[model samples]
Target: MARLNVKPTRMELSNLKDRLALSTRGHKLLKDKQDELMRQFIVMIRKNNLLRDEVEAELIAAMQEFVVAKSLINESFIEELFVGTETNVELNIVEKNIMSVLVPEMNFTTSEAEVSSDVQYGYLNSSSELDEAIDRIETVLPKLLELSEIEKTCQLMADEIEKTRRRVNALEYRMIPQLQETIRYIQMKLEENERSAIVRMMKVKDMGD
Candidate 1:
């Protein structure tokens, strides 16, 4: 660590001591914040990982079920049944603060959220596989949205954690050390000057005698 460029005097020394104390307090505060942020980040990342795995598995299962349903029916009929259907979904994102990081919390509303007891189309041509496939996809839709929210939150938290870590490091390894070194240097200079002044005073008295 390097000493700050400052005059070696009682006033400067007092000011440096105040600065060093402030820096020490600031360093401790930043370090505590860093630790708390890391804790929050780890919890969110683990939740993201688990939710991602679940969403992936469900999506794959739905896709596989759809492929089987397609193989058992005419592709044109499948397209005609689904292509014109409108699913109105409204998505809203709100920001939540976690460890001083603003992350997104998502909400969604679907227009056709109700389950129909009666089949929309004739059951004569509809295979059970097709019905099951559609149901699987419908069930997984909310989970997909939840996974999106969790992933976004994790991303924001990671960014915040990295920033906090940098600040903590700067205080612990750079600013605090520099302040301490400069304070020590000023103290030494002041002491040496006092000794020199005392020697001059003795020399002057002996000369007068």
Candidate 2:
């Protein structure tokens, strides 16, 4: 049902034949690329699911610890003791390429707010339990970020796969077949014309004889 705009001529037919060949080759290549990308996307999707679950579990545990820490020690004392010990933290992020796809890498760093607490005002001070909670939160943060990035990358890859699939279908099922049919039609017409011309020439020669 699809219509091509240009009028078909000898030159145009030759060009169509060449284009049909190129499209067939391109279709195969794109099909392979799409398959590879889909495989990678599926693997990343599985990893993302696992990481998401782990992050959720760790976040819950950290929250519970925070509650326990708050109950065990006075808020004012904990605040005073930890405030001055805070240090600045910087995270180093790197990008990784898989099958020519660039994915994000996450790094965790300890910040001043994480290390320093306000516990100087009273006898009660921050304990290892609080540090444990902070550590768990820090550990989960990067994983959560990684999961997010992976999920997004998978989505983008899926979209590309769909687009490639459509192009392949068009070439393999529609455009190439139509071009071949047109070529056959032209060849048959030319053959018929040649046969008719030969028969007429023979009749004229016999009459002259």
Candidate 3:
């Protein structure tokens, strides 16, 4: 590292020493923060993975039921049923902080006054498979929303981890090293000057004797 441009004096050495102390302390704190963020990030990733697997399995099962229902029923009837149905679902988003990262919390609400049952279609014209499919689809709704929440949280945590990693690296590799080198240079220069002054004083005393 390049030596800092400063006078070879005791005051400059003291000042550089102080700066180095502060930099060292700051580095430790930042490293601790990075460690905590990493721990939180790993937990989020695990949750995301589990939620994704469960949601995918549920959706696949629902799709199979839908396919069976389609095979047993008329396509026009299925279309007509949806066309006559009115859906009123509202999504509200709330946020909370985790390790300084903002993550979304979703609340899914359906109008109970308008939508009360899982089966939107009538029983007379639809097969049992259709009803099963409808029930499974309804069961998947909250899980799907939960999956979305976890995935978004994972993304936000990942970003924060990366940012923290950068800062830690900068301090550990670059800033701390530079401060140490500058402090060392200042100390060495001051010592050499002090030695020179002592030698000059001794020679002058010898001449006077």
Candidate 4:
């Protein structure tokens, strides 16, 4: 590695040594952070995969049920029922810190929501299949929301890991090496200057004698 462009002096060497020490310490801390972030990121990825699989299966089943329900009911009536349906669920978004990374937390509030069936059409016109389909959809809604949050967290953590890794590499490969080389050059220059000064003093002493 190339030495940094710095003055060949004791003071410059001292400053470079100080910077190297701080850089080494920072590199160690960032390595630790990268390691921990990787661990958590892997765990989050696994959870995201499982949750996505489960959510996909649930969605498929719910959609199948909905299709069957649609086949039994008139399309216009189904559309009207959907249009008239009222939902009172509220979602709150908050952030939490993990390893210096901010991740999302979603909280749902449905205190005012009715627990009864959401199949708002008249019983005489709506089949039991429609009610069952609506119930299945409702059951999977929370899991779907949870899957979204987990996936986003996984993405955020992965990004942080990448960023940390880049920083660690830069310090280890570039900045630290340059500082060491520059310090060595300065020390060599100082030693050479000392030897030259001693030789000149001896010559002057011999001339006076």
Model 4 clash pairs?
Answer: none
Q: Which residue runs does candidate 2 get wrong by more than 4 Å? A: 1-13, 71-102, 106-129, 206-209
Clashes of 1: 0
Which number leads on TM-score? 1
RMSD of each: 1.8, 4.0, 1.9, 2.0
List candidate 3 segments past 4 Å from native: 113-115, 118-122
Query: Among all windows of ten consecutive residues in candidate 2, which has the lowest summed lDDT?
Result: 115-124
Ranking by lDDT: 4, 1, 3, 2
Question: Pick by lDDT: which candidate is best?
Answer: 4
Per-residue lDDT over 96-126 for candidate 4, one digit per residue giving the tens place of the 0 to 100 score = 9999999999988664343465455577778
- 1-209, model 2: which lDDT tens digit per residue? 44355554667668878887898889889889888988888887888788888888999999889789878888765566556555566667677766566666666576656555332333346666776777787677667767777787777777777887898898888887877777766666667778999999999999999
Candidate-wise lDDT, in order: 0.82, 0.74, 0.80, 0.87
For model 3, what is the error of residue 139's alpha carbon versus the real structure, in angstroms, after optimal superposition? 1.3
Error of 1 at 78 (Å): 0.8
Q: TM-score for each prediction?
A: 0.93, 0.72, 0.91, 0.90
* Candidate 4 minimal-lDDT segment of 10 residues: 111-120
Q: List ranges where model 1 is wrong by over 4 Å.
A: 113-119
Instruction: Judge candidate 3 against the unseen true structure and give its global Cα lDDT, from 0 to 1.
Output: 0.80
Question: Which rank order by TM-score, best down to worst?
Answer: 1, 3, 4, 2
Query: Candidate 1 or 3, higher lDDT?
Result: 1
- The deviation in Å at residue 35 for candidate 1 is 1.2
Give lDDT for model 4: 0.87
Model 1 deviation from the true structure expressed as Cα RMSD, one decimal place: 1.8
